[model samples]
Target: MRIYGPNGTTLGAPTGNTRRAGASGFALPDAIATPETRAAATPKAAGNIDALLAMQGIEDPLERRKRSVQRGRGALDVLDDLKIGLLSGNFDASTVNRLRDAAASLKSTSGDPGLDAVLSEIELRVEVELAKAGQF
Candidate 1:
């Protein structure tokens, strides 16, 4: 039997039993007996518990809140500097990158609703400025 190509050219039927070597099947590797493999996987929640325990060592809730506010203020100051530089057309790529880094590094979550709101607004403004400058 013969086969015709799409363009009506005479193409001969497949001629050989063309099963290539190493193409027959796939096999997953046997489980390695390494030390890590032998050890049981730690539960994800175990890490969370450790983090919670570490947080408990903070002791003073008020001090923790104060630190959060201070971090927020520092982030705000960096944003303000970036804004000034942008307005003056004196901003460089490095300054914008630094501002981006600062914005990303901000982990302030002051318990006070008003302060949190202000921090959110400042963060939004920084995002907008970065977007306008095509830095985001």
Candidate 2:
């Protein structure tokens, strides 16, 4: 299985042929999705408009960042779920491609001036996140 970072970049394949650490010694696929493991996998935050628009109800700079990151997290989660469905015979090729295109567009048009200003710096991360959820 392919796991992606919060920004949507491929996080390399699961250590192929390697076993994950376990209580007794090691485990494989089953060990990968244990409740503890999943619980520990926190989603990363993205964007930072709240600070730029402090008068718009978002007072705390950190809170603004947290909200933006949460949004990104939601999009990534959607993408991951859709990816699974598509790979599992739920989506036809044409639909998949269409969704991919849509995702690309969303990624390009996040509509946040702060992000747009730093387009050079944030494009990759934005695209990756949006692409993951077909929100581009």
Q: What C-alpha lDDT does candidate 1 achieve relative to the native structure? A: 0.64
Residue-wise C-alpha lDDT for candidate 2, range 25-123, written one tens digit per residue = 645554455332233545555657676566676356566555555555554555565567767967545444544553444354334567444432343
Q: What is the C-alpha lDDT of each candidate?
A: 0.64, 0.50
Query: Model 2 residue 101 lDDT?
Result: 51
- State the number of backbone clashes in model 2: 8
TM for every model, in the order presented, reads: 0.49, 0.30
TM-score for candidate 1: 0.49
Pick out the ten consecutive residues of candidate 1 with the lowest summed lDDT.
29-38
Error of 2 at 122 (Å): 9.3
